[model samples]
Target: MGFSVRALDTDSWAAFAELVEANNGVWGGCWCMGFHVKLGKGRTAQQNREEKEARVQTGDTHAALVFEAEKCLGWCQFGSPDELPEVKSRRLYEKGLTTLPDWRITCFFTGKGFRGRGVADAALGGALAQIAQYGGGVVEGYPEETDDRKVSGSFLHTGPMSAFENHGFTRTRPISPHRWVVTRTV
Candidate 1:
């Protein structure tokens, strides 16, 4: 079956929640809040879950959820820097960040048993399209390059460099050993 994409609003919360629950609250109780202001530090999984759910209800969080037959397979999380300020290699990132993009693709999550099936790509495409609908502007993402060696999927929540490049994002700067700040005007 073909994949479908939807905005992560109240209506899609159940599906998104199911995916997170299945993944053990996602990367140890993150609920995809690692980049959000909350950070979920010293918080319980249920606490993070509740916080994320509340944000979803109020339409504060943003993501493109990819689904197959009513089961959400994955998602690409994106929002303004204000909405998602926390990031890896923060010091290096701020040093070279000349201007913040209108939207930032913070991370991605593919459901178990659905990896390597183009879910992340679909989520990325859906996110850029949605960003355009909201008035297109520059978009940014931090993705790792895996040209010389293989990187585990679990460590790729930020996404892969190739996916952004495929969507027209260019290599702007490097923040970590393998991760780089990539951008494109969506």
Candidate 2:
């Protein structure tokens, strides 16, 4: 089935919540806010959900949500450097960061039973298209490169190297053994 993509705007908040809820709040109550908000003590899944919902309601949420008909199946989060303070590898990324990217693709979350079926690729493409609408610039992403090694879907929240490459992103530098900073001048 073909999919449609849209920004995580107020109108789409319900669909976004449904997708995240289906995934158990996404990575242990992350609510796709790992790069946007710091995790703290006493945080609960409900709190995360509420915070994310508030962000969406206030138009602060920046993500591309993929829908097969009306069901949200996947998402790709993107934002300006200031909006996303930290990434997976802060130190390494900082070392190679000569300049901040106009936008950063921080995370991807595909619903259960929907992975490995081009959901992520669609999300990334949707994100780039949205960025282009806002006047494109340097877009950065940090994705894991397994190099033929077996890796779990849970470990690919930032997405995989091949998906980024498929969307025209090139490796800028290595952040970790299996993670690299990829970029594209979209």
What lDDT score is found at residue 28 in candidate 1? 83
lDDT, model 2, position 169: 93
lDDT of 2 by residue, 1-186 (tens): 599999999888899888888888888888987888787788888888888888888877699999999999999999898888779889999998899999999999999999778889999999999999989999999999989999998879999999999989999999999999999998
Off by more than 4 A, model 2: none
Instruction: List per-prediction Cα lDDT, in the order shown.
Output: 0.91, 0.90
Off by over 4 Å in 1: 38-41
Question: Each candidate's TM vs. the true structure?
Answer: 0.96, 0.97
Residues 47-71 of candidate 1: C-alpha lDDT, one tens digit per residue: 8899899999888899999999899
Worst 10 residues of 1 by lDDT: 37-46
Candidate 2: Cα lDDT at 174? 98
